[model samples]
Target: MPRDQILTFFSKYIESELGMIYSESNDFQLQNRLEEIVKLHNFANIGELYQSAQKGITGSLRQLVLDVATNNETSFFRDPKYFRAFENLIEKQIKGDLFSDKELRIWSAASSTGQEALSVAILIKELKQKYASDLSFSILGTDISERALEKAREAKYFQLEVQRGLTTPQMLKYFTKNDKDMWVASSELTKHIQYQKMNLKDAFYPHEGFHFIFCRNVLIYQSVESKIKILSKLESSLVDGGFLILGVGESLIGLKQDYETIMLDNAVVYRKKQKILKVA
Candidate 1:
């Protein structure tokens, strides 16, 4: 097939199937990735691959496209400032007689491979040991990729993945090294976290209310319209005055007015406005 035709097919297919938009300038990358798919599917050429995909000769191939397009390049504690801010938020929320519920529920909305979720779990464990007594906490990690969720559920990581965001003491406290030097998260840290597969663009919300949500860096890939829609849904799922953390580069400044932005030391988090109760 001609390059223009191939580009058109990919543009429409990606946008409709995975909510990804590929521009003309992405020809080289798209061609390279498509070639990999073609080789994997045993297609002779790009044209053949497109034809087979159109005919549904390979159902899983379609899913593969979506996966490749949406796969994120992430690491443990990609942003340290956010974690610091998170620690402060937790401390402030639980210090005085403000809430005093002693129960905190957190959601890592785009927890690619569970590092962020596990990181939060580790921090919470540290906090519980230091200050809060008999605190109840749950951290739910959700991603759109089943494969990623499976990897997260395993609670094992390569040495490289474990190296960042963890000190030697933290590693010794929360992880065990296998024969290959791979790090496996301790059962204690894993106990508080549950992994689930969720598509943020879905019509209905997957999880219930959460005290805090980390959806950083994921929305940048989405269109502005999609971002607003997803943020709106997230707002509904957050408790009033609950916190929403986005990537340092991501913001809701001009996107939505429903959330009030709160600036921490280095992180800017959004909070839904609480409705005041009126006395009769």
Candidate 2:
């Protein structure tokens, strides 16, 4: 088979599996990544790799492709405004007793390397110390990359990773340096956080709905239809009047009408719109 045909086949396959778009503009990127995979796996060429993929590449090869294709660019508290917004919302909820049983549930949908989830945990810890001593919360950190999840579970970061969006006080307070000089997340942050492997394109349901869901920096890679589907699922996974925090530039303007846009601090967030019942 020709090289163009192989690239086209793999591009479509990646979209069908991951819902990640690979247009002509990004063809070079896709081709480069595919070639890297070919070299990594010692395949003769892209065509040979494609042939192997077609012949039941269900295990390692499939996971390798997915891992290579995924963009796991994340940092601790990547968006300060959003974190401040989340903190304010939680504080308000706590004061108003909006929590049903003094317990909060949060989902970091594309958790990446667990920074976002751990950041939420750190905020919750602070809130518990200052306002509600008995407040308890659980954070679910999920991603599509097993490699990323492994690193997240380790909860260790190099100096540069810790320095990105983390202050000196926060780094000293929440992390301890190991012999290898890697900063590890404190127990207080990790105790309530759990990591899992999840694909946003698939249907997902949590055992219980979350008060807030952070599915950031991911929908941009998906098609508009895929984005709508993902947004619908994320909405369903939220409790009534729950919040959905997306990436800084992401908007739901033309996608769905089920959410009410609101601003907390300087960050824009969405709240699940309550349904009005009609009397027959």
The lDDT per prediction is 0.80, 0.88
In the range 112-185, model 2's lDDT, one tens digit per residue, is 88899988988878887788567778999989899899999999999999999888998999999999999999
- Write one digit per residue (lDDT tens) for candidate 1, span 1-280: 4568876887777766545567777777788878877777688998988887777534578656665656566777678888888888777765753355568889999898888899898887888788955667899898876667888999888887888778889888999999987899999989899988788888787456788999988887777888888899898888878889998788997795688888887788888889899999
lDDT of 2: 0.88
Clashing residue pairs, candidate 1? none
Of candidate 2, the 10-residue stretch with the lowest lDDT total is: 93-102
Candidate 1: regions farther than 4 A off: 1-3, 56-59, 97-100
lDDT value for model 1: 0.80
RMSD to native, candidate 2 = 2.2
